[model samples]
Target: MKKLLYAIAVSATIITGCGKDDEPTPTKVPVEGEITGDITANRTLAFGNYTLKGMVKIQSGVTLTIEAGSTITADKSNGEDGLVVLNGGKLIANGTSDNPIVLTEKSKVAGSWAGIIMYGDAPIVNSATAPAPQVATSEDGLSLTYGGSNAAHNGGSLKFVRIEYAGQVITTNNKEHNGFSFYSVGSGTVLENLVSYKGNDDGFEFYGGTVSGKNLISYGNSDDSFDWQDGWRGQENTNWFAYQTGIGNYGVEVETKGVNNAFWPKVTNITLKRAAGTVTEAQSEIQLDAFQFKANGNGEFSNVVIDGYINQTTPTAFTGGAVQIRDLVTYDNQVLTGKIKITNVKLNNTPTVFIT
Candidate 1:
């Protein structure tokens, strides 16, 4: 068990009132019957509470649709509770803004379970366990093999939901799981208004996928708020605050793999903020490059408002190399003729490179 927190002390702060002290959480009466193994048909998780005790793989020919205001709890005693949507599987989890569906842990602690994994047949370059096309299950220490020719493949719908306390490092090889791991998921899916909190790993991560998203929020999480890799053409529509609690690591950490391929994602209408805390707390404890874009990732970050950062230049704003450093005027096809509208930030050190 490779816990990322080795005495990582963090003050318990509420983000969206999910596990906050001011919110009234619903009690979960653990479902007795097992919802494990491969789901066979169209199963609708109606207004009720359920528990998943083991590995659940939604077989290809089925649609697992979860209704609004539904709460699904998990008990990770032996680290088995995980939801995997296969290549051809479809999920329709449509929760509203007021009554969003919530998937939480029984203990309500961070690093509870493996996490939700969405797999598809997208395109990729090279993989350690996968041979470009015919990828093996040994790649990510699990059975979610990703990559294909279809760029518009639809895995399912994960909208208006709160995924809390997932991303448990199950095994030594299984430490990379996030709250929502989109592995080769395509664009024909629906991922909107998704929120992840208090997870031990990244709130959301994309591994060689082309799926876009909207209205994503993460708070108090132990890792990056958003992470993407493997030539992803992510087109996020809109976003809220990129808040950081005492346990949060980064706001956005994007990597282009060792290939350093020139790939970009369109991120629009967002505000990045680091919550105020002690000098040695979350916001101030950011690394040399907190919001680093590794492997020369090119993307359009337009209409971004940054606030509440102690020293903007200490942990450099955007740090990464690029094969072709486009002009600051043009990014991800949007023409940004002005600055990123940085306000409320206390800049001490002279700034280095930004948006290249």
Candidate 2:
């Protein structure tokens, strides 16, 4: 039982209302039931082998604690969506590395089910309140309605979890779903030690929020490893170890819509390794653009390494940037040989050498 653990220590001084003088509180009243449709509760809700057919909605000021090793399977046979709506609620999914919480498709294959979709009412850019898009439904014909007043809303925490083989196709624009999709989530939410393996689309996607994360890994994904759209202001300390066996697309990508808003996403300590395909083609590692930041979007990358084989590509397509070359070492048919955007970078091998 391979384990991944995410330890979060929330600063009491930083968190509003959580005063140091306040005594430890006892557990609130528990709300136990078998949910088959939309679930809205103000207390703790637990699930078993039960299949959540529709949307499971958790209201504000409530705490939804999912026990370790509990599996919440969504019905995918129907055209419904499997969703968990947390509008002003807190989620404490504390799964240990050995007993991780698994969110998978009903189908056994690599890509079979829709992923978890979260929406809040916190403030969002260009809109005063939550954006009202078409509510997604569940496989059992339940409408998962969310997104209002709380646009940049905050939730609980997601630690030591594994979202496997998710991200099903829902629309035609290639808006395929993701393993864990966060829409209008606020700075209050914490995500740590999460693993998304073998998804159909993006492993983890964020629309808008003030998110901060650490120790995250994505394996064998079809699209980007970490994709951020809308306006995401977060800090990610990630170790992006991809499939040494050829699995997904780029390592990390940051894009925005226009320049009116700021898409200033800061990433530190990122390590991207090439997996399958040729090093060049499959390992085109990091892509950064100000699509959403427009004129105001300023992206920053520090202390990173992008080392792999340069699959035969046109010279015009082989341009590199940012990642330090000296701190990188290659294996097999791979080698570290050049310097990219540098604050302080070094190259160990001779300048003309191909093998390190």
Tell me the spans in candidate 2 whose CA falls farther than 4 Å from its real position.
Answer: 1-35, 43-48, 59-62, 121-152, 171-174, 236-247, 260-263, 278-297, 312-356
Return the top candidate by TM-score. Answer: 1
How would you encode candidate 2's per-residue C-alpha lDDT over 1-356 as one tens digit per residue?
Answer: 12332211222333457678888778544333454544555544453444556546565666677766556665567544455655666777767664566666566455566666666554334332434331222221223443334434677788877777776666434456777777767666778778777777677877656666666776666776777655566656444434322444445554443323423566666555444242222444422110111212235556655544233233444333322122122121111121111132222211221211
Q: How far is candidate 1 from the true structure (C-alpha RMSD, Å)?
A: 9.3
lDDT against true structure, model 1? 0.64
Question: Candidate 2, after superposition: displacement of residue 318 in Å?
Answer: 8.4
Instruction: Give the candidate number with the greatest lDDT.
Output: 1
* TM-score of candidate 2 versus the correct structure, residues matched by position: 0.65
Q: Which lDDT value does model 2 have at 9?
A: 25
Among all windows of ten consecutive residues in candidate 2, which has the lowest summed lDDT? 332-341
